[model samples]
Target: MILKLISRSKQLVPHSPVRILSLYAVLALLLFSAVLLVGLMPADAHAARILEPKQISGAFPTLAASFNPHEQVGHDQMENMDHGHDSGLSVSTALFYTARIVYYTALLMAAGMMLWFSGIRSGSDEQRKRMQQWSLPMMRALLLASLLYVFANARSLMEGYGGGGPEWLRLFTETNTGQAWLALLILSLLGFAVIKASDTFKLIWALLLLAIESWSGHVAALQSNMNLGIVLDFIHLACAAVWSGGLMILLGLWFVDRKEAGRFAERFTTAAWISMALLIITGAAITLLLLPSLSYLFYTSWGIWLIVKIALVALVIVTGALLRARVRRGELPDGLMLKVDAGLMLVITLIVGVFTYMSPLPDNTPVRFHKMGETRHFTVNITPNEPGTNQFEVKIWLPEQLGEPSEVKLVLHSRDRQQLAPLEVPLAIFEDKSYESFPGFVRTSYHAEQMDIPFPGKWTAELQVVDKSGEKVEESIDFENY
Candidate 1:
């Protein structure tokens, strides 16, 4: 069966595989069209994704209000965005994800072709010819995508974190997200220089490119077990690139010559098989890193996108198996199935580009409580304000009148449920500048903190302050756990 493709390459075919690839090209465009439509959904509409998406993936999409899972586009914010402004935001977002999608496709395709051709032990001429024809364009796409991602990402970040920023150039150099963007831009430039380099050089280039992807991803953002997360993300990305990139190059080769392409396809199917195995394995490892809990899969937008990606991947695998079976039986494959397989891979890439940019930590909205008593001010702030174990910080203002309080306690109580027992955590000295006492102020600031929340519900936190005179001034505010 493999011999058929090898022999067929030597013989002339009646038609160009260009039309078939043109079919793939149309499918690719349609895939992008779908991504753009979803990306440009109304601001509030985007906020409700779960039944939604995770991107803006790989770059600037996180800065786009439409795609940032951590910073939701609230109704009030959306209401403020009149149709014109809304349209502009949507367009900005659309460009961000679109460029990223194109970038991923091109980078993987270029790298995959390098590996594909390398499989031909003796076809030095064939390899060199294909590299000359294809490598530069793919690298150019990477260069172009990186530039757009930088511009859009900088713009989005400035809008979010700026008066327009700490400034855009500084933003890239000083921040984690920005540094990663810079790496992408720099690496892509380097990619162009190495297009015609040796197979070993190409392999290194591909690994480096995949590494850039890992840097911006949720796996890299893990507060704990970061090394494991990065490994999982890299392996998963490599497998995906191999599978998708190899298929794309193969289709292009089929357009050139079926028999010659067959030699590569025989090797590629083996690569695809290995890649699929690692894809599943690394995907599971990544899930453990990204998913907060099993229940999140059923309810969160991130979980839903993951579920869809899983289903799409399953479809791709089944289709490929059927097509490979046909090849094994000494029969020709219907080119349409291959196109479908390619199309599905593209869609999976789209899904990944978004969610991979999503926050690994599940929803943790900010929660704060502030109130003034006769002689002191009390406050509590919860970061990522979500259920389960939570960080609690309490601040007290000790006027010259109150002096320093003898003790401060962060006491928590349930207002709506009985199962939740009351919790009291003494905020020990917070020596960090943000929590430290600022000198020369009329009112001294005292900050204390603990991390021990066990659940989420309607609750009340009471700030208890004891004066040196043995009197207690207690202030309480009703707030809910996130």
Candidate 2:
């Protein structure tokens, strides 16, 4: 068991300062080597056409909006598929993210306490008794969090469906998220039976929970290099859970029993160091596998959040160094740094929740934009904004006030410093029943199965409509020609 690893790690020969430096030097070398490999290694060039956008404009802000903007294809849809801006967070989206953060905290804290207090022989009687007193409540919290996660995920999947219980059940039981939630619920329920079980069983139980989380993660289902992705993510989540979760419990110990906490801090912090090392390595690898290109690091919402997470993680690392120094100096030097570490960790957890919620690939995610007006709305969607075969969808909406349009058409023109004639594309009236999300607007849709984008460059799409009175309205959008 990994708990046995914790005990064994403690008995290893102590490293002198020179030896510690050497170890760090070796780790740094490996880290750079890994980063280099990721950089040189080709991304999945033949990615899905209907890509997940590397969550380009999809993150916490975008999660509030639906992924399938084509359902109603109106104002809400336009807002969601907007290229760069964030849509307001919806209530359901908020609930999903909140449930996720709660479950993350609960899982980390509960599992860390169980493993440290029961699995490790070094843990004192007081620690074991304390863990016991907290076990029931912690298990209940995990169960509750798991249930919340299940409901929130189901609600997200069922958005705009307006289906009854049967549909909801189908979505849960038939989808990947549903299966993951099922496993999580079962594991959470199993935790109750093992609350007072043997320490080895507790370790196995904790690992099973981590495995569920990893299996449910986006990495696990990666179509390219799937096995490697799943294994890396499982190990990644395990290490992160051990370090962050144990740190949370350690913080609690500091408050309730500082003397015991002081005795435990050095060993726990030392273990955290190793866990953190693996965490960084795998996290970097996962990032490389998921991100479409290096440019995405600056251009996308997911990338931005990742930068924020990494920055905060650096602060946590600094706090860890401070803690290690304090432990070695025979004084905590006040718990100010500890509080700082906990606060940073909590924020990082929330951001991590965003990462878990969004898609990692550039497949279905699109470069979508729209022009809205008092009378009409024009929208365009280009899939996987890359030079190659792509899918294009154009939607035009006219309010009832405008009456029946005599003529409505869309035109395309290349914008690369060259004189080119405009090409007109036919549009057809589209009707959809799901009007609850975006109502009052009648929409017409045009779809192209495969548009061979000749090159990666700028192009302009123009929309022109003629009202009953023969008055013409025009609008154009310039895009990277996705």
Candidate 3:
């Protein structure tokens, strides 16, 4: 079956079998990972533990049927569903996954552009003009898109709430009324039309949009640390797009028009150098912010994936440098360079596919909790730490006159406010009670015991504190780690 699939891939792709196989390999990995994550999910507290697969299948048949026994779909589901909630995987994972997929797609588009550019021109002035005539509209469309982005971003900046959400709209806009939104839409169309007329204006408009994006990010940062995450996310996106998108354009011109290969190669080489530098710098900065320690890099799934991405990027640079040297020495034939460039770009895309499967470091952090009990009810707070490592502290408070110690039970399970459950994770803690000489009550705190969780996802920690007489209090906290 695999061989047949490979054979079909070779027939479908215009490039080499190796290239087609590489793409399929990446797709397989992504599908496998996603299935693994979903299939292995743990059940909520209300669920009964049945040895029968039928019990499991009856509830999640759509998910179960997607995997074979060896896929460990059930195992991962049990592990994730039974374990505690993850704080890291929520937002950071979302950002990393989204960014990597988009960047990879952009890289593939670059490869396509290269092939198109190289295959199109036959050194005739008439043919070159004709190609340009056809391509001009595409350029105009891209410019128009950029302009639209600019206007939309500008409105977001001016209104403070931006198109991203209602919160951003409320933050920037003096009035969150329908008329303002309508006006912004009209302005965006006007901006797009204006920018598409010329390259110079398009460039200007793109820059303006960039400025607006930056400003909006800055404003977002002030509201919460999540804003900083938002800023970094945008920067990562812009950098990825510039490098990948620009490369796609350059490759297109070189491969499609053999006559213009030399000039296009030279121009692309220069741009590639700049893009490589930016990619490296921003990538490093992102790493520092998320993977602050070697513990994170070596221990966490997100860290491991990031390491893989860095290695791939290095491979890309080396390949690009080699190609640049070949072009300089006139050793690479025009047609061959096109194929080689496309192949290498494909490698980048594949690496990005893996990256998308991994969680982002900034978003995946361990959670800590502090508990306060009132006469009427008990309250619990779950505080998330910096991304990468899983370590959280728990604190408990009891009234002095209760005379009996409360049996505090903490359960780390996988579930959310959406559909939650309790898991049988028997966490044991040994602590001694000492009087602090406070006026009335004693405060009991538990030092954080580090849980070495490798992957990024959602987890919930439930606390069940009972007195010696069996009077009990219950609370739960949710966390996500990427």
Candidate 4:
């Protein structure tokens, strides 16, 4: 269907500068609004605790901490979580995304140069000379970007770990991300040494580099049918590189000679369309695998970002179709349109970098566990046992002689006794109607409430209930916070 639409839109019509400007203006407005909406929306406070540092050390504490370096390490680990965007502003994360953009841009440029070299036979002498002129510098940039990516990634990992030494080394040597980085370093060295290699070899190596990148992302963490996920991810990364990289090369050549660039642009448009089709298909499949339901697409932060990416990609496709139409008409392609398309692609790449670090699952639902009360005959089901905010659901079942409880209260006690007072959880009745009786005892009521655990450790929950007869029953359940 996409191909048919592209084919139908291929006929050249008069290029109107006003229309082009208007199109871009609309796109800019849409993008700005989407960003503003995301910014204005409220972020989950509990979700932020999972990623951001909760506090900053005071000057006096820092000075005193210098005497005990190990204590500082522990403090840093406790402070630095998974570094989610909702948590806070993270300089390390910003740098990491910057590094990713540079690295991927360099990779695409290298791949574009290879694509250009493969078809060097079809172009004029001047065009061939232009390709040779840009080739070495692009390869050198790729090597530099690859090295910078490694350094930035290592620094980010160190920040997450609180410090780096043997731990960093272990991560690099033992983890899948580390293995992928090691492979990329080797490829970078090879690329540097063979700057003037055959086009096929360079292209093959570039694809390999991108494939390793796929292994470093969320796809690699899949436990069910892992091979299928990795294969789809590799194809997605490869197609993206080819489409974007080819454009980078075309943009450069278009400046040298628009007439000469038209021929290559025509060929690239066909390839780009094919790449775009595959991207949409693979992207949809991956999204379905990761997302729990359609509701998450709007309700979760991850889904909002995915929507932004889809919008940017739609802009790219529209721009590509217009460029192809201009090329087919034997007219100079719209330079402004091409630039807009390339800029959007770069922004999309940065979004991809952000997504790589984020969790796809919604924060509202987490790991759940149930606790049974021995004397009170009630069960408390805790949704998400993590050391942060949680929801507790209580279900009470009474014996044939005992009536349903009239009141229930939840209390939290710190095992270490460091807290000044036990925290109380105010639970409201969720379902109070009596259950149908077929057995000796009948199920009664259920209550639920939200609570926060400030720290990770052992804690005890005390449930106190007042029966219909005014008899009070107390039961305690112990659990550990992650």
Sort the predicted structures by TM-score, highest score first: 2, 1, 4, 3
Candidate 4, poorest ten consecutive residues by summed lDDT: 56-65
What is the lDDT of every predicted structure here? 0.61, 0.66, 0.44, 0.64
Candidate 2: clashing pairs of residues: 50-363, 50-364, 51-363, 51-364, 51-365, 52-363, 52-364, 53-362, 54-361
Residue-level lDDT tens digits of model 2 in 1-482: 12333235554233454655576577557656655666676543222222334432342232212222233222243343443223688775677789999988888766766666433334366666766777889899999988887777666545554447866665556555566778888889988888878676887788788877877676654545444556677777777777776676667678888876776676667767877887788888877666655555665567788889989988889989989888888875347887898899889888987767765533234668877787777777777656555666767677766655777676667776457676565555555343422356767666664555554346776777787777898877777632
Candidates 2 and 4 compared by TM-score, better number? 2
lDDT of 3 at 309: 69
Higher-scoring candidate on lDDT, 3 or 4: 4
On residues 390-416, what C-alpha lDDT tens digit does candidate 3 reach at each position? 344445555667633466666666543
Residue 418, model 2: lDDT of 56
Answer with 3 or 4, whichever has the higher TM-score: 4
By lDDT, rank the candidates, best first.
2, 4, 1, 3
Name the lDDT of candidate 3.
Answer: 0.44
Query: How would you encode candidate 4's per-residue C-alpha lDDT over 1-482 as one tens digit per residue?
Result: 00111125553232244644464456446434533443343332212222222331221122222322234233354565453333466776667778887887787667656654543333246765777777778878888888899888766555545335776676566655666787888887787655566555756776777778776666555433334456667767777877887777678877878876676686677668767877876676566545434455776667888999999899889998999898778777788987888898888877876666666755433433344444346667666765556777776666667756778888888895555499887687665554534355546655554476654445788888887778887878887543
Q: Residue 1 deviation, candidate 3, in Å?
A: 47
- Counting clashing residue pairs in each candidate, in order, gives 9, 9, 52, 0
Candidate 3 deviant stretches above 4 angstroms = 1-196, 209-242, 298-302, 331-337, 343-359, 362-482
In model 1, how large is the Cα lDDT of residue 364? 47
Candidate 2 — which residues are off by over 4 angstroms? 5-40, 45-87, 117-123, 360-449, 452-478
Q: Which residue runs does candidate 1 get wrong by more than 4 Å?
A: 1-89, 124-128, 160-166, 330-332, 360-362, 365-384, 387-451, 454-482
What's the distance in Å from true for residue 467, model 3? 16
Global Cα lDDT for candidate 4: 0.64
